[model samples]
Target chain A: METPLSRTDRTRLGRHAERAGTTRSDLDAVLDQGMVCHLGVVVNGSPRVIPTGYGRIGGTLYLHGSTGASSLAASPSQEVCVTVTHLDGVVLARSVFNHSLNYRSAIIYGVPRPVTDPDEKLAGLRAITERLAPGQWDHARLPTRKELAATTVLALPLTEASVKVRQGPPIDEDEDYALDLWAGVLPVRQVLDAPEPDPRLPPGVPVPPHIARRATPTS
Target chain B: METPLSRTDRTRLGRHAERAGTTRSDLDAVLDQGMVCHLGVVVNGSPRVIPTGYGRIGGTLYLHGSTGASSLAASPSQEVCVTVTHLDGVVLARSVFNHSLNYRSAIIYGVPRPVTDPDEKLAGLRAITERLAPGQWDHARLPTRKELAATTVLALPLTEASVKVRQGPPIDEDEDYALDLWAGVLPVRQVLDAPEPDPRLPPGVPVPPHIARRATPTS
Candidate 1:
């Protein structure tokens, strides 16, 4: 379990901090809620962060990418820091600097070693697939041996991870209180529009329940 | 003026990219479209990447955080890289490694200097607030000099920025295409919910036009 590095690092507002809470279940809850993540790694002594798809299994984060990918594949041996964030709402404040965001984010720091075992590689791949669009794995084609060989999957134990959160109303200075400014949270969320059926579907292909529900976002 | 670094770095189709068709508007379209960006930098010879809200003015990226914030505030003075990504969708493929995303992303590399000038600092602060939520600056209270003093904002010139994108159907191995599997692009998008009125707005303060129009995301 990870705690705020120090007291100050923990946000002051009790509610906002609770909203930013991290639990064993929160990890799976948010991770199951989204598929893509931003991957940050050091290359040539500089930080390079790229967005990629990742799946979480228990306390391990499984990430897969092209073996030929420039940065991720090139620097396979280095310790990488991976983060996945879902922006829930925009917390508007009375003061510009006080503007805050209601978001759920997970940051993991660990050395990610490339997975070489063939069986583990396939499992890792499936986890990422199902994580993105549930039940799509059975609906879609599975990977071939050669394809799996050519691809790269990395497994990072979610040992050193941190979660920080800020949500709700803005905290402004006392003087700004009497100012005539509109202040509140302008809730921002992701909505799934009517799914556009695949162009070549074999007629009457009903939309799956998972995909349908995912289309409608609850902020 | 940002050039593709190499074949691998370019944002094109039939290649390893996502969200291919999203247009690359001159700096404004991309910058104005999104508020949060991942700032990647090296700390103590290690790569440290963190996500924070930002605003772009002309050709500069302005970022702010508490003066006492750990690591992030101190990073601007050193070499830093910033990536702004607007995710359009998740490209679930027949193969796991081929599983990708559709997004518009900008990567900027440079050395950022802290904003000591009071005027530039003020403007940077406004840009961040407005970028997060349009019309926020006008409605929200502006920052005070003393509060501003407690925050640090850095403006990094966007000279070496590069945009990479991918959108559309997934390309799988020829044989895998015949391997009865479901695979296609599942578009992911962000939406804005109805504005939540402030608790102290004295009830029935009709929402502003900007806020009303943005009830649903245009991005």
Candidate 2:
């Protein structure tokens, strides 16, 4: 059986407790499905939230950036928060106060450790690359020594994370439901369009199957 | 002429300086195009990033949440970072190290002030609602006195902000481009699906024009 997520005071949900997801699977689902995450770190005594790519393998989340990036440089010594959110839909209600968004969000809190071990760094980089493009790690040329040296990878354990999901229709006041107004959900989705080959790319190089599969309509 | 965005040491980009946007229009475009934002605030000496909905009006950005929310309650006294990111596509390169994402992101840092003036509070709430669902504030029942009191609205000025955009194909090494591998961009987009009327909603109340317009394909 999969383990339940550890609930510290920080991970506990105080409001809308019903929206909290307690399983490790919940956290993984939210993290895996997202292509990018907002990384929050305190710099110069103020919070700085940055949108960056991220990856997850088992219980650890991996983030990589240029070694000279200020946010990555300042993160190792302090507690940082990483959040992934998927906006599912916009809930329209009979009342303005009742309108809401259907979304799945995961927040992870921990002090990250810089990955220095060669084997682990390679694995972390692979995970990050694969997360961004599933088959590209094997298809593309692997990073050379100098490229790896220029990158900084940080591993954050998923021991302290929380997932919250809000879905379904808006919960309007009982009286408002009787009003002669329309109410519903406008679903939102992320879709991949046709691939545009690089202008510099040589002629007759077809798009790979892995990338083509994403453009196919699932529904 | 539009006022150029203020440049402070914190807002300055050390790496990829060419990607930084200096005009106020750039910041507004990024903010207005996104439906949700990641809010970062420090709580208990640790950074906390929450995925929340926000609205922008001129020089002020407004965010609303239940008064009981811990993140909202702790944010007014300290500096917070709000980031909005729209992923345009995934850049495929000949090498793993050169892969990147095409995106536009805006980051705003400021100390938020609670909106206490009754007119401003209502206006803030209206902006928040309108942002989530355009034409919603006018169609839905306005918040009553008790509902307004139950909500907390925080307004952050757009004085300290930055915008960054990365677009086009990956910048691969000169030699790697000659390899016979597919290199391109797989575009990513947020699209709206058909509206799902609330099951509890009474029949014969048609989907409003505002909501219907979103479901129509833009491209």
Candidate 3:
């Protein structure tokens, strides 16, 4: 059986307790589907949030940044919070006060360890690259030694994480349902358009199947 | 002349300084376009990040949440960071090291003040509601006084904010450009699908023009 997500005092849901996700898969699903995560760390006694790309390998989450980035530099020394949120829709209710969003969010709290092992570093980088563009790792030139040295990868275990999901139509108050108002969900989704080839491309190189396949619109 | 954005010691860009956006309008544009923002606050000496909805009126940003929320409750006492990010495309380069994302992001840092004035509170709630649904405030029933008392609205100034925007195609190294690989941007966007009316809607109310107008896909 898969291990369940940890529910410590910090991860415990207070307001909408019903929306909290229980199992480990719930956390993974939210992390895997997201393209970017907002990483939070305290610097000079002030909170700083940075939006950056991330990848996950099993229970370990990998985040890469320029070694010179101040936020990344300050992250390893203290506990950090990484949040991945997907806005699914807007919930419109009969009253303005009832307006809420349909979203799935995962929050992980941990002190990340700077990845130093060269082999693991490569694996982490591969996970990050493949997460953004699948099948491109083998097709493109891999990172060189100099390039790897300039990058910093940090790994945070997914031991302390919580997932919250809200979906479907708005729930208006019992009396307010009688009101003459249009109330429903405006479903929102991220889609890919046709790929724009580089202006410098020399003649006949066609768009690869991996990239082209994703460009097809669902709607 | 339009006022430029304040550049504090913290807001100064260190890496990729060229991507920094100048002027107050640049900051406004980034904040205005986004539907959600990640709020960062230090709670009990550890950083906690929460994804929440926000709206900007002039130079002040308003964020609302349940009065019981721990993140929102802790925000007003100390400095908080709010970040809004829009992912434009996947910048696929010839080498994995050169791959990047085309995105626009704004980071705001300030000590939020809890709005206590009843008139300003209602206006702040309207701004937050209108930001998500343009015309819903007038269409829906306004918040009751009892409901207003249960919500918390925190206002943070846009005085210390920075915007970073990366657009267009990826830039590869001179030598890597000769490689036989597909490298370009896979443009991404959030779109609305057909509205799903509430099952309990009392039959004859038609979808408003404001909501219907947004459902038409641009692509």
* Model 3, C-alpha of B22: deviation from truth (Å): 1.0
Using DockQ as the measure, what is the rank order of every candidate, best first?
3, 2, 1
Q: Which numbered prediction scores highest in DockQ against the true structure?
A: 3
Candidate 2 structure quality by residue, lDDT tens digits, B143-193: 999999999999999989999999999899999977889999999999899
Task: Give each model a TM-score.
Answer: 0.86, 0.99, 0.99
Prediction 3 TM-score vs. true: 0.99
Where does model 2 exceed 4 Å of error? none
lDDT of each: 0.69, 0.93, 0.92
Q: Comparing 1 and 3 by TM-score, which wins?
A: 3
lDDT of 1 by residue, A1-219 (tens): 543322223222233345454555655566677766778777666677877788877777899877777666755677777777778778766677777887877766667889988888887877888877677666666677777877889998765666656566666667776766666667766655555554544466566676666565443
Candidate 3 error regions (>4 Å):
none
lDDT (10s digit) by residue, model 2, range A167-187: 999899999988889999999
Between candidates 1 and 2, name the one with more favorable TM-score.
Answer: 2
Give candidate 2's error at residue B92 in angstroms: 0.5
Minimum summed lDDT over a 10-residue window in model 1 chain A is located at A5-14
